[model samples]
Target: MSVNNIHEWDKGEYNITTDIKKIDRTAVHSYLTRSTWAKGIDFETVSYSIDNSLNFGLFHREEQIGFARLITDHATFAYLCDVYVLEEYQGRKLSNFLMSCIHEHPVFSKVRRLMLFTLTAPWLYAKYGYEPVNQQNYAWTILRKDMYL
Candidate 1:
C-alpha cells in the first residue's frame, strides 16, 4: 500500500505491533543520517546496535518510516534516543503516534524515570512532558578518556 493510503488509516488503522521483525536497516540509516545528530554513526555499527537494543519502528504497509529506541534496565531508568521520522513523512504526527506506541508498550510502561535529549523539536518533546534538566544541580561526574580508556 502507498504511504498516502496508510496515512489515511484511522487512529487505530494499522496494528501497532511491538515486534521489530520488519525493521529496515537501510531506511533507518537514511533517517539517522538525515537527523544530523547522528552524524558519526557508522551504518554497520548502528545496524548492530539496533539489532540488540530495545527499539521500535513505525511501519506503513511494511515500510519503516519512523524509529525510536530505549536504553533501560526494565525497572528503573529509561533513556529514549534516536527518534526520527523520514523527511517525506513528517508533519503527519507519526512521531507522536510512534511515541504513543512506545509509551504504551508493555516493556517500557513500567519504567520510572524516562529521559531524552534533543537539539531540536523541544516543543514536540515538551508536549510529552519532557523538560530540560539542570546539569549543574544534578550530581554527576564526567570521566576523562585517560581514566577509562
Candidate 2:
C-alpha cells in the first residue's frame, strides 16, 4: 500500500501530520541524537531513516516539536520508533494524540502487529494498548546500542 498523500490531524492548538515534507530533520536529529536509544546518531543517518519510514510530525504552528515514525509495509507489521514530544510539549497529552493518529491511520488499519522498544514512558504507551512482548513468544533482537555511531 502506497501512503504517498499527507494525513493531517488536529487538536486544539496542535496538529500531527504525515506530510514528510513538514518534518524538520534538524529538530528530529537534535532530539534523537540525545535520546537513550538513538544516542550518538548523526543527522545524515536520521535523515536517511526518516526518508524510509512513515513519519508523523507533531507541530505547533510551523515549528516541529514532537515526532514518531513507523517502519512498515502497510500490511502485516510495523515498528514504532523515534517517538517523542519535546520536554516543553510534554504533559499536554500530545503523545496521546500522536499515538491515536498512528493507531487510527488508514495504512495501519490492517496491520497485524505493531512493536516499539522503550526504556521509559511505558505508562504512556500502555494507555494506547501497548504491552510487553511475552518472553515465551516469537520475539528476538540483535539490538546494538549505538549501531551507527
Candidate 3:
C-alpha cells in the first residue's frame, strides 16, 4: 500500500513534484477554500481528499506555491482537479510545467480517459489537448455545487 508514483521537474528556482509527502496541507486548503469551485470547503475534507488522491505540488525554493490533484485509479481513468498557481506566481509558465509533468507521467500510458473541470484557464488546457467535452453525448456530471458546504 505504498503510493510512490512521483515525478519531478526543475527549472531554475521553480520545482514541481508529485510526491504527496511534500504537500503543504494548510496552504492548499487555504487556496481551495477561496477558489470559485471549492469555496467554504473545510480543512478536514480537503485533507481527506489529498490523502486519497495523487497530488502534484509546485514550489519556489522550499515554499509551496501551487498545487493540483488527480483522482484516479492509476489504471483506467483520471480526473484532474483543483489545479492552481498563486496569483503572484502566475505569468511564469509554472502551470505549463505542471501540466507537462502530469502528461509525462507513466501511469497515463495505461489510462483510457482523462477529465477535468475548469471555469478558467481553458486556453492553457487546450494547449495540452483538452477540449470541451463533446457536449453532444460524451460528457456529463451530477454536479452538486455545494456538496461540501
Candidate 4:
C-alpha cells in the first residue's frame, strides 16, 4: 500500500501504512517490552504474529513509531489491539492517524463491530468512537493464547 494514500488525520507528520513489511519488529519489540501494558509480550512471538497479521504500522522516517492490529474475519467482527506509540514518538498524534487509516480501510469499513481493550488512553480512543461496553453483557473467552506463542 502506498503511504501517500493514507489520510492525514491530526496533522500530516505521520504516514500510516497497512503494509506490514514496513514494520520494524525489533523496534516495536523494544517499545512493547518497556510498556507496562505489554510487558508480557514475547518478541519472537510478536514478530511471527506481525508477519502473519492484517496489521498496520505507522512510520516516521522509516522507523516503526506506532502500530495497531486488526483481528477480523473480513465480514463481521474486528478487534483492534496492541495499539502503541513509542515513547519518543508520543504526543505527535500518530495513534489517531493510524486509527483513522484502519477505520477507513475498505475491509474494516464493512465490519459489523470494532472492539478494543485499553487499560489507559481511554480519552484518546473515546474521541475516535470507541466506548466502554458493559463487560457483564459482552463476555469474551480466550480461545487461543498458546497458538501465538
Candidate 5:
C-alpha cells in the first residue's frame, strides 16, 4: 500500500510517528548495533529494511528515541521487530504508548497473524494479547547465528 500521509500520536512531549522522513537512521543504527537481536547488522541492511517496512518512530522533542518495524502486507500477516525505547527513556511507559499507536493503526486490523520475537519481555507483549506458543512446534527456522561475523 502506498503511504499517502503521515500518522502521529502524542503524549505530552513524546510522540510516535509513521512519517519515514522523520526517522533518524543513524540513531536507530547506533542503537541496533549494540542491541542483542540486531547486533552486527549493517547500516545498509538497516536502511533497506526501514525503507521496505511500515515503521513507527518514537521521538522526544526532536530526537529519535525508539523504533519498531512491521513487515506486513497489510492484510494477512505482520512480523513486528526491532522494538525498543532508549535506555534512558525506559520505565517511562513510552513503549506502551508506541504499542498503543501501533494497535490503533489501520494496517493491523485485517491481519490474521501478528507475531514478534522477543526473549526479554513477555509481560509487555502479554498486555497486547500476545502469548507464548506451547505445543510441539514443527516450524523450522534457518538461523544464521554468525551471518554477520
Candidate 6:
C-alpha cells in the first residue's frame, strides 16, 4: 500500500483509521489537557502536531473514542505518542487493534526503529514487541513536563 493511502481496520462496531480528516481535534485536545503529561497544552499546539504527524483514530461508528500518532521519517525512525482510548471505552481491547493498525501501516513498513515513552500501560505495549530502552545511551530526552501550564 502507498504511504499516502488511508489505512483502516475493523473490529466489530469499532474501527481504526489513518485518515487525518477523521481525527477529532477537539476531543483529542480535551483528553490531552486532562492528561498528566500534556496537562494545560494549548489547542494550536495540538492542532499543529496533528497536522504534521501520522495519526490513528479509533472510532465507534462516527464518534471518535481513541487516538494515537507517530512522529516519523517513515523509514528509519518513528516515535509513538498521544495514545489513548476514552475511559468509557476501556475494556474492549481497542488499544490492541489500534496498535496493530499502526504496525501494519505503510509509513511504518520500513522503519528500522520505533520508540515510545509511556508512563502507563507498558504491558499493553509489551504485547506488541515494544521493549524498554535498557541502555542509557539509547535515548536522551529533554522533557518539558507540564510546559503549557
The 0-to-1 C-alpha lDDT of every candidate, in the order given, reads 0.70, 0.91, 0.89, 0.74, 0.89, 0.91
Worst 10 residues of 4 by lDDT: 2-11
| Per-residue error (Å), model 2, residue 52 | 0.5
Q: What is the full ranking by TM-score, best candidate first?
A: 6, 5, 2, 3, 4, 1
Let me know the TM-score candidate 6 reaches against the reference structure: 0.94
Q: Ten consecutive residues with minimal summed lDDT in candidate 5? A: 132-141
lDDT (Cα, tens digit) per residue for candidate 1, span 1-149: 12421111224443344454656888888777656567645688678868776777777766777788887887888889999877787898888887777776655668888888778789888888888888786845463423211
Choose 3 or 4, whichever is better by lDDT.
Answer: 3
Model 2 lDDT tens row, 73-103: 9889999999999999899989999999998
Query: Candidate 4 vs candidate 6: which has greater lDDT?
Result: 6
User: Which parts of model 4 are misplaced by more than 4 Å?
Assistant: 1-13, 142-149
For model 6, residues 1-149, the per-residue Cα lDDT tens digits are 23458888889999888889889999999999998779999999999999999999999999999999999988799999999999999988888889989989877788999999999999999999999988978689898875999
Steric collisions counted per model: 0, 0, 0, 0, 0, 0
Provide the lDDT at 68 for model 4: 83
TM-score of each: 0.78, 0.93, 0.93, 0.81, 0.94, 0.94
Q: After superposition, how far is residue 147 of candidate 1 from its true place, in Å?
A: 18
TM-score of 3: 0.93
lDDT of 4: 0.74
Q: What is the lDDT of residue 80 in candidate 3?
A: 95
Tens-place lDDT digits, model 3, residues 1-149: 12355678888999888888899999999999999999999999999999999888999999999999999999999999999999998999999988988887777677999998899999999999998886686686798899767
